[model samples]
Target: MGRRLIVGTTIDRVDDKSLTENSAAANRTSLWGGRFAGGPSEALARLSVSVQFDWRLAPYDIAGSRAHARVLAGAGLLDPEELGRILAALDDLEAACASGTFRPTVDDEDVHTALERGLLERLGSLGGKLRAGRSRNDQVATDLRLYLRDHARGVAARLVELAEALVEQAGRHVDTAAPGMTHLQHAQPVTFGHWLLAHVQPLLRDLERLRDWDHRTAVSPLGAGALAGSGLPLDPGAVSKELGFRTSFANSMDAVADRDFVAEFLFVTAMIGVHLSRLGEEVVLWTSQEFGWVELDDAFATGSSIMPQKKNADIAELARGKSGRLVGGLVAVLTMLKGLPMTYDRDMQEDKEPAFDAVDTLELLLPALAGMISTMTVRVDRLVAAAPVGFSLATEVADWLVRKGVPFRDAHEITGKLVALCAARDCALDEVSDADLATVSEHLDPSVRDVLSVRSALAARITPGSTGPGPVADQLATAADQLTTWRNWTAESVVPR
Candidate 1:
């Protein structure tokens, strides 16, 4: 019979008057009540999301249904025979759908109906009581929460990869000296590894936010039918456990209406996007001809159509552009919830698109950025060459005078005079010989010239969190250990397909 049907691939089914109905059997109050009496106008059904979009929640819906079936069996609502038939039918329906043998038609309207209809067809009407305690309001909300929890981990895992990539880069460049900036002007000499590790710290906070959001979305809303608790004696806690939720929602109204999870997830994504945008801005700046502190691999860069010499940092530019979209996603969720009431509303349909977009954008962006960082070359010689051009070692010379019994104010004045003399001569501080130094201050002895050297200035910073080699090497070891722990945890949690 199956082979015969496969030849032409047509199967007979019953007519569906339910599709034209303004609401499903679960809700009698029509969305457009005054306009219609019997069924919806054809124009309205075409615009509804129930038939098109809600079907995507089928897997989550079926999983919830299986748990609900067990709840119903435990509550004494179903006899053993009826419970067996319902369980068998639901399992058969899931398998058929999973194997691509089931085709849900347009008339079924949503996953809820498609599932019920599939069950009835398989078990010859014994599957009718399975949905008695539920409504699509709570069902979809539960499904969406489950879906978000699963994918939030995925987003978190990708973020860990990006963080690890940054740590790896930082470890490799632990001793590489680079110019650190404030207000886009050279401020001091810092290790390139320190700068890379700085980016990792903010991203680690982003990872924590993601992991926390996963726990927040781990609650179930299955037994909250419409705006009130279901009349049936349902075991919501049991259902929550079976479906991998951490808790049952406390209030039925809140369970059906709350979209805080979506908002929070988008907020986390937006903040992370802000961090990525900052990284992108730095990469774009460093890769420029004027800075030339870092060189991007050609694969991650692009050339202008007209200018042959133009190798634009297009990957970073795209990352920067996508951050606006992430910000927009957060704004959209907040806008959707601004005036929503205490229960479920059509306005909540705006939730999934933003959540999905934020996740999708980050998944593409994080891995691409990791790849870019892994391949990009650092111009250490260029950075070191640029470091001294801005008199970056001036502070060390001032400090040396302070240690020689000159008050800090006097030392600062002395260093200022010496710097002024060097500027007037158009020579570097180190280039000013001991004879020229003694002319500025008697404290500017032969030893003062040693403090002017960049290497000496860097080595003088032996304090914790300084740009000196010892503290930088300590930071590298700490960062590597943290990254290793995160990688091992992530590797163990690989959810199988």
Candidate 2:
């Protein structure tokens, strides 16, 4: 009894699976083909997250198996009847798992073992032969690659949607003047559209990265079994084709162990998170009473418990906080991969949690960001009012002086003296009397002050990509065309219905 108890405790199944299944199969001695001499230590299995987390890949695993079965039959490894049984069992197993009719055993260490056991239960001993040339090493890698491929496409699509929203809002606000910042200090005048475009450009690069990574993840890593190529006359290309993989992995060890794709995806996600965090920070500042340039919707904001008047940008704040976690996820994967051997290690098991977390985090964040942006109201009057609060039009005054035959350096110095004179009089350049402006320098003419207003200053900058109304409108139109092209591409390259 004591020995039985010892063996039973060491080979426990995943709890998340066992709750729905019966106790008999859940108490099985081994999850694998009983290859090892004895059962795993009970304490070890209890502490394992393998079965619990890996089961999420069951659908992909079943799909890969069906593809492999077809390739095996093509290579004359399995007879037609055997192939039919395997394929049929795979389909049935998929439906069972999807509909919650399948139950995993406690002894099933990971998704691979649980799935094979299901096949064996359904097809009798014939299911056992399916593992003849396959190993979990290649199987898990293939499943993860397929899963990430799908997710990469999804993430890119969402990015396009968010980018389109930004462009639309920017187009509406193209003529609205605002202050541009340097070191968080008001430096010059810029249209609000230009600010929005700055963010759209970064996301566009991020989307491109996802698109490229999607192709890199398109290959199948199956048939590279157990740190080396399988001994059988297995055709990996056939498996790749059947499983929708663009190509087969080149080296067996690298194929089984390579997690650079995950790392790359995570890196892209981290950069995206950083972008989101920056946006969140801006929204937080803009909505505060101190700034008051924009007002967040009540739906996107929260009220404080103690302060009845408080409306906090909670969603944006959460997005900001989640960026730390996304960074942590990238660091975690790097730590796991830092000193590993050539082939797959148990350390590789730590890979999915980070990838899954990053993907899930972005999925939640992108839509929230789009919502906040779409619903929030930008106070154009407030933005414009703040535009020239701190001598923002000083550059325009200098340029006006330069146009009137003053050397640029001399014009810049004259503008500085004029600013100091206005400061002494406790007034703006526009507020200073013509005689008062002349007190600082003889160069300050009534005509120079005439072009110093914000609108006049902005209209003078008609260069391409400038914040002048005409240039801003042109930029918005160009951004609109790019958004249309992006939308069409996202619709085209996505998975088929």
Candidate 3:
């Protein structure tokens, strides 16, 4: 199937519906309506509904319910027959939900409320037993964790795919020389492979971040019971194990209240965004007329509507632009979390939208970027030709002088002056007359010409992890190994395909 982002949201104009009907199904939205004499006002219903976005959590919620049902069965809240029927009904409802045959109604308040309504319809009064010793507070917390944990696995998978693309490109360009830049000016000669591997380092760290995030996220909040321990003997550990969590939470209030996982997830996603933006910025620059170091594949580039000659790097531009949205998601979740007191609050419902939006952004972006990186043509000739521009070999001159017992400061000054002399004479560094080299500095000799070539400059950077071709080849090997390890982790993370 073609890649797409599927989300449930109320960010746009909402669908208008009448909530005035007094039916029990419509009123089922307000689980707390038991305390009120009358149902909520239509205005409140319209403003308060979260099924619009939270419905995306339905599958996770159902999974939690399945686990919770087993816990309830263990607690003897229901007999064996009731447990079997509820489990069977949950399976049917899950399939219906996944196939889109089942959906949240207009009056369903949130994912928890909507799923409960579905349960009630499926098993009648028997479904109400499953709600024993549980509340939406803990249910939502558990469900969100399940949802993000699963998606994080998928994110890690897609991220590794992007890294693989970079590694493959780096392999192709391992011997291709390019100008490594500082302050937008060529600073040194480097293999394009080395520069590409530099981008992969941060992505490897991102994979580690996701792997670590899973550790903290694996504690289940399912039995927290509306911010207090359940009076019933629910086996939270059993439920946690059944739901694939490493452990059950120790504190009920903290379990429901803690949103550290979400905020951390936002930060992780934002960091990935920032990294991709940097890669995107380079793509934009390299594909431009001024750089001409890269050419986008026809499949990836778009034609400008007004400018017929333009083949725009829209994927790169969007990747760069959407980073702000990812950062904004982090900010949104953090800000919403800042003022909340202990336990779950309505404010936290807003968390899913931002979190979901970022996942949507990355899901669409990573594959497109991977394809772009894999297919786009690297202009090796342009890269090699530009490697020595802007007195790029001046550093080589300074380093050569340093080897000849010249102080680096004095050598720097001599190289600077030589560069100026070349600029004034409108010539290459090697093109300078021997007398000019003699006049510029006594340190300058005919042998300085030996270090002026791009190949020599590339070979001179021999330190570990330097832009030298050997280190770059090693870097690609290291990156490929890291990508392999992460690929194994995602495969075991148990996220549905």
Q: Highest TM-score among the candidates is held by which one?
A: 3
- The lDDT, on a scale of 0 to 1, for candidate 3 is 0.86
Model 2 agreement with the true structure over 254-314: per-residue lDDT tens digits: 9999999889889999999998899889988899898998898888889989999998898
Clash totals in order: 0, 4, 0
Winning candidate number (lDDT): 3
Top-down TM-score ranking: 3, 2, 1
Over the stretch 26-48, how does candidate 1's per-residue lDDT look in tens digits?
Answer: 43322224765677656765555
Range of the 10 consecutive residues with the lowest summed lDDT in candidate 2: 1-10
Provide the RMSD of all predictions against the true structure, rounded to 1 decimal. Answer: 6.6, 6.7, 3.5
Give candidate 1's TM-score: 0.85
Please, what is the whole-model Cα lDDT of each candidate in the order they appear?
Answer: 0.76, 0.79, 0.86
- Better structure of 1 and 3 per lDDT: 3
